[model samples]
Target: MLIEVEDDFRSSSDKAYEKIFDMILTGQLKPGEKLIRRKLAEKTGVSTIPVMEALLRLEALGIVESIPYRGSRVVPITKEKVRDWYALREAIECQVMRIITRTLTEDEIADLEKLANKLDAMEQAGDTEGEEFWELHFEMHMIMARKTGHQSLIDSLHRINLFRLLQRAQYSATEHKNQIPKDNHHCLIDALRTRDPLIAEEVMREHIYHSDSMI
Candidate 1:
C-alpha cells in the first residue's frame, strides 16, 4: 500500500522535476543561470510542456524565478538569504528536536547512525562532487522530522530544506568548495539518542547554524 502510494506520486512530469532539481542542487545549473524551456526539455528528454510544468513547480518552491523578458533563472545565493533560512530552521527544528528526544525510537536512531556512517564513508572515499553527500544530508534531517510524528512540521521543513539546498549549491559554487560540515550529523544523532531535549535542542541549533560564519 505504501509502495503504491509512493509510485503513484512519481509521474512523467516528476522525472523532469527531479532532473531539474538535481541539476540546480548539484550546481550544474549556476545561480542566475538562465533556464530555457527547450533546452531543459532536451536535457530531461521530456516534451516542452512537461518541462514548463516542472519549471512552474520549481518556481513555486522559490528555486526558480521568472523574468519578464529572460524566462526563468536560478535564485542567487546571498549571506542574508542563508541567514534567514538558518533562522527559520532553528525556530522550527528546535521544537522538532524536543519532540524527537522524547519520542525517537531505537530503530530510528540505528537508521540515523547508518546514514551518518554512509555519509562519512562517502567523504572519505573522495566524494568531491557531493551528489551523494547532498542526498544523504537531506535524508538525515528529513528523518529527524519524520521521527517526530509531526506531519505539518515535516512538510514545512521539506520546503525549507529545498530552499537550503539551493543556497548550499550556490554557496559551494561561488566559493569553489563544499560546505558540508564534518561529522555534524553524527553529533546530532548522538544528541537525539540521549533522550534529553535540552541537549538535542542545543545540538540541532548549533548544527543548523554552523554555516552562519561562512555566510
Candidate 2:
C-alpha cells in the first residue's frame, strides 16, 4: 500500500514537472518569473507536494532557482550568460561532432540525416515556434552526443539544452526577427558526412555562433 502511494505521488510530480516545463518552453513563464507553489499546484491540478517536487527537479536541472525564504523563480536570461552558454556549448558540441565524425556508423548517419530532413521540412512549413519542433531540434543534437557513447557529454548537453530552450523562448518574446537558415542542419550533416573532424568542428562552430544575432 505504501509503495502504491509513493508511485502515485511520483506520477503526480512528473505531471507537474511536465506542465511547468511546457509553460516555460511555451513562453508562458518568462525568465525570472516568480513561481508560487500553491498557484502552480492549482494550475496543474495537483497537490502542493507534487508541485514542490517538480520545482526541486527543475532546480536541479538549472532551469529554476530557489531564493532564500522567498521561493523560486525561472533562471534569468542575460547576454553574458547566453554568451557563456554558447562558449561552453561550442566547446562541448564541437568535440561531439569531432567524435561523431570518426565513430558514427553509416546507419547512424542515415538516421541523423532523416531527422535533419524532418526538421528542415518543419522549418520550411513555418512551425519553428511549436513545441514539437523544439523537442525534435533538441533530439537531433542529443542523437549526436549519444553516438559518441559518452555519458558525461550527453549529461552536459542535456543540461545545456534546457537553457537553450529558455534562451529561444526569451528571444521569441523579443522583437528580433531573424530566422534560422532553413539549410542549417542540412549543412551540418553534410560536413559530418565528410568524416573529417576539423571540417565537422568548423561547421559546428559556425552553426552554434549563428544564434548570437538572435539575442
Give the per-residue lDDT of model 2 (tens digit) for 1-215.
00011245588898898889889877899899999999999899999999999999889878899999999999999989988888888998999999999988888888899989998888777767776887888889988998899999987898898888888777762243237678878888899889999999999999888766566
Using all chains and alpha carbons, the TM-scores for the candidates as numbered come to 0.73, 0.81
lDDT of each: 0.77, 0.84
lDDT of 1 by residue, 41-85 (tens): 899998988888888888877788999988899988777777777
Candidate 1 lDDT for residue 58: 85
Index of the highest-TM-score prediction: 2
TM-score of 2: 0.81
